[model samples]
Target chain A: MLDLHNLRLAENGVPHLDSITASFAPGTLTTILGRTGAGKTSLLRAIAGLAIPDAGEIRLDGADWRRLPPWKRPIAMVTQQFINYPHLPVLDNVAFPLVRRGEKWPAARDAARAMLDKVGLAAMVDRRPSQLSGGQQQRVAIARALVKKAPVLLLDEPFVNLDYKLREGLREELVEMLRTETGTTVLYASTEPREALQLGDRIMLMAEGRLLDAGDPRAIFERPATLEAAQVVNAPPINIVPLEIDTVARMGPFGTQELGALGRDLAPGRYRLGLRAGDIAPGGPHRARVILTEVSGSETVTHLDLAGLPLVMHEKSVVAHAPGSEIGISARLDRGFVFAANGALISQGASHG
Target chain B: MYRQKYLFLLPGLIALTAIILFPLIFTIRVSFSGWDVYNPGLSWAGVKNYVRLFEDTRYWSALSRLSLLAISTVLIQYVLGFALALMVWKDVHARRFFRVLFLVPMMTTPVIMSVIWRTIFHESLGPLNPLLDAIVLGGQPWLSSPGWAFAAVMIVEIWQWTPFMFLLLLAGLLSLPSEPYLAAKIDGAGPVRTFFSVTFPGLAAISVGALLIRLIEASKILDTVYVLTSGGPGEATETASYYIYIRGLRDFQIGYSAALSITYLVIMIVALTIIAKLMVRFLVKGQS
Candidate 1:
């Protein structure tokens, strides 16, 4: 097990990691889901002993990792950028760690060859890193990291640099490869919600250099503990609109009667309404103006403005909503979340079932 | 119609021909003629000077001695310079100060520095012998002895040029990407292993370039030998350049000296080209 306690680091008075405490159990892959500058890389770097925390305790398998130098730590990390020894061939790049740890040439090469074959790059073993394409180079880096068979592995958005198609392909390949290393504790950091949900056994939500929540991927997606956590784990970005619980909940453009079963029984107070992009559907009683529309893969994400409140609506397949065009929209408030004005979750809407 | 484009290159072309080609072509012509203090004018000697050069033992010995001096001094400078560069490359107190201080010797005029060094190696009167005596080593003849005079020339050469190697190697170090070092550290590589596997291999191309430049410079060693030893102690420290100067200017045998200079230039070019090829083959292509 890898454990961190009150990890705090500040660079030039800008906090990179603010009081982070987390742990990774063996055989579990935890996806640290956060947008850019959310300290995801910093957290992984601290675990790999590359970055030192100002005040923290890192213990791995009951040993103090703080006392160990990076070379002494039993860890391996694959960064977002494909980093391989340019001087070495693909085979030697993979075998480098083994050789450094006193493994003989033939044995190390054999292990490297096997790992390369697993990552689907056995044919390019003799080629240098520069000779390969971007995706292939990252595979070499991944193979090198995996060949060590280290107990703890840290992957900081390793496939994020590749094109979308390539990213998905490599992510699946990594999952298949990681499955065989059952005992290795893995920490994969990413910004995409789908990737975090697809790969991680658990998800860690981070914002502003602080980890908001960590739990089962599905549970975190369904019931994020805070508004920031929900925004981090959603793709089109969750819409946080102000809510007034008077006789009934008044939120955005949705009047009390149009709220369906959502605003029926809510405590009377001012609160924030957290609505996932999918919670807002087209062709409803209330009208919203389309601010912008984007089509990605099979889904269309549209930005909407409803009576001065900004909103995002996610639609199923290829739907064209022109900018400045008015469309009828409605909120599935039963599937949304009610939060305090301070952004703390007060109550999550019950599941449709 | 596009002939005007050629005019753009005219200035640089003219400068190249005037600065380099003119002197080179004139030397080749001079080497074939009998031009001396007595002759005073260029007169075709029918390869007589070239034939005489083949039997000149002093010139051959000087050539051999120069080769030895250049290779040994350059090799020593590379090692010492690389060490000094690594010391101040990162994580040292007053690193900026030390970097400039290391380069102090290279920036000084070579002839002037050699003059100062001559006094430093002046057996009884020099501070070096006294410092040696204080360290419990007895003082010996520094300039009067043949072997010591050759060594003195080498010492001065190494001191004057090591900074050049340091500058090139340090720039190479600074330009290397930081990611590889981080990867090496995470891979459990110790200091020695990291150096061999990462740092050394990364610097291979620059190392080849620096070595070739230093080798080319070290071959033409004249100033130190002229100031410190003056080819004394039975020509022990007489490099090819110094010997050529003796024949050309001191002895006033311009034609013979021109032939010697031409032969020396040809030999250096051939030798350095072969060395560069070998280095690239081993240090660069081998790794790749």
Candidate 2:
């Protein structure tokens, strides 16, 4: 296990990581998901011993890793932008790390060939990095990172430059490789939450350099520790609207509607409700007008004008509602979350966390 | 249609004849004949001037000394320039300020620099000798002795040209991709191995550019030699260009000087070509 105890990093007096403390289990994939400048890259660099935290300690397998140099550590990194030695053939680029570790040149070359074949890049052995496509070059970098047989691997947005269609394929390949290569801990980081959802054994959410929440992908999706964490992992973003809970709850444009059965028992106060498009549905007694509707593949998404405020609902394949048409909106309040005015989580799925 | 296409080239062709071809033809013709500024008549001397050029002892010695100056100055300039560039390539406190300071020497006009250095190298009146004497090593004649005069000229050349190499090398070092460096750091490669494998290969093309410019310019060196020593104390610092100037202007042997100049030109072109070819041989395979 790799433990980062209270990692705090600041740049030019501006704080980047505000006491990030998390432990990544061995042989498991821990992916940190965050938008740009959220300190995902810095965390990965700290793990690889490239960026030293101002106040923290890194221990690997119960040993203090702060004293070991980056090269002396048992890890290899694949940068976000794929980089290879332009002056060496693909074969040599892969063989380089092994040679640096005191292996004989011929033996290193043989091992590198085997590693490249594993990544399905054996035919590109004689080609230089410049001669290959972006995806292919990343394959070479991956091969080089793997040939060292290090127990730890750090991948920082390894497929961001590839085609969008190709990115999912490469991500799956990498996740599969990490799975098959047991006993190797992989710290993968990306801004795309769907990538984390698909590949992370443990999903780490970060915002403004703080670790917001970390748990199994499904569990975090269901009970994110904060409203902000829920917004980060949603595809079309979660709908967060303010609620004025008076004697009767005031929700959306639907004038002073009674609180739904799930929220009826809550104290009358101000709060924010966060829910995905799937949380609300059609064919219910709560009345609203359709603002706009979209049918994609097997699902239909209808934006509803609930009173004067907007709410969106996802329906099955055949449902259709024209614009400005009145329709009943139902709330699946069991799947929604409530937060305080300061954005702290007050409840999960209609109950206190 | 073909005539119209060829007609478009007529103006440039006429200008080339007047500027380059005319002077080149006159020089080639004059090199084969006996002619002087004092004589109005041109006598066909065939290979007589060429034979005399081969037998001239001063011509051979001057070429040897120029070769020595070119080799030593270029070596020192590249070595020192590379060291300085590497020093400032990383996170220095005032990185741009140091780069601009290093470029000050290259920014100055070479002729003016040579005149300034001449004063500093003056045997008796210069501050350099007094400073050396104060350091417990007594002063010696710098420009008055033959060997010291050559050394003084070489010093001025190396000082001015080292900055030229520095700027080119620094630009090259900065242009290197950051990914390979990060990869190397994680690959367990030390600083020395990273330099040899990652840094030097990336710098090979720029190194060739720096070397060629310095080598070709140093071969025709005259400004520093004129200001510092002027080929004094028994002809120790005379290069081929300086010798040709004396032969044509002072001795009035324009034919022999022109012949010798053409021969030296051919030798220089051949030497530079060989060096460039060798530097680029295996590098072209992956130097990208």
Q: Please provide TM-scores, in order, for all candidate models, with all chains considered together.
A: 0.93, 0.88
lDDT tens readout by residue for model 1, A1-353: 89999999889999999999998999999999999999999999899888899999999888998878899888889999999998899999999899888899789999999999999999999999999999999999999999999999999999889998999999999999999999999999999989999999999998878989999999888878888888898988999887888776667567654344556566688888888898899988989999999999899999999999899999988899989999999877878787777788767777721
TM-score of chain B of each: 0.96, 0.93
DockQ of each: 0.71, 0.52
Best by lDDT: 1
Tens digits of per-residue lDDT, candidate 2, A11-108, equal: 99877888999888888888889888889999888878888889888888888887777888889889878888888999999999999999988999
In candidate 1 chain A, what residue range of length 10 has the lowest lDDT sum? A255-264
Misplaced by over 4 Å in model 1 are A257-265, B1-26, B42-48, B138-140
Worst 10-residue lDDT window, candidate 2 chain B? B279-288
Name the regions of candidate 2 deviating beyond 4 angstroms. A67-69, A243-250, A254-261, A264-268, A281-331, A339-353, B37-41, B282-288
Quick one: best DockQ, which candidate?
A: 1
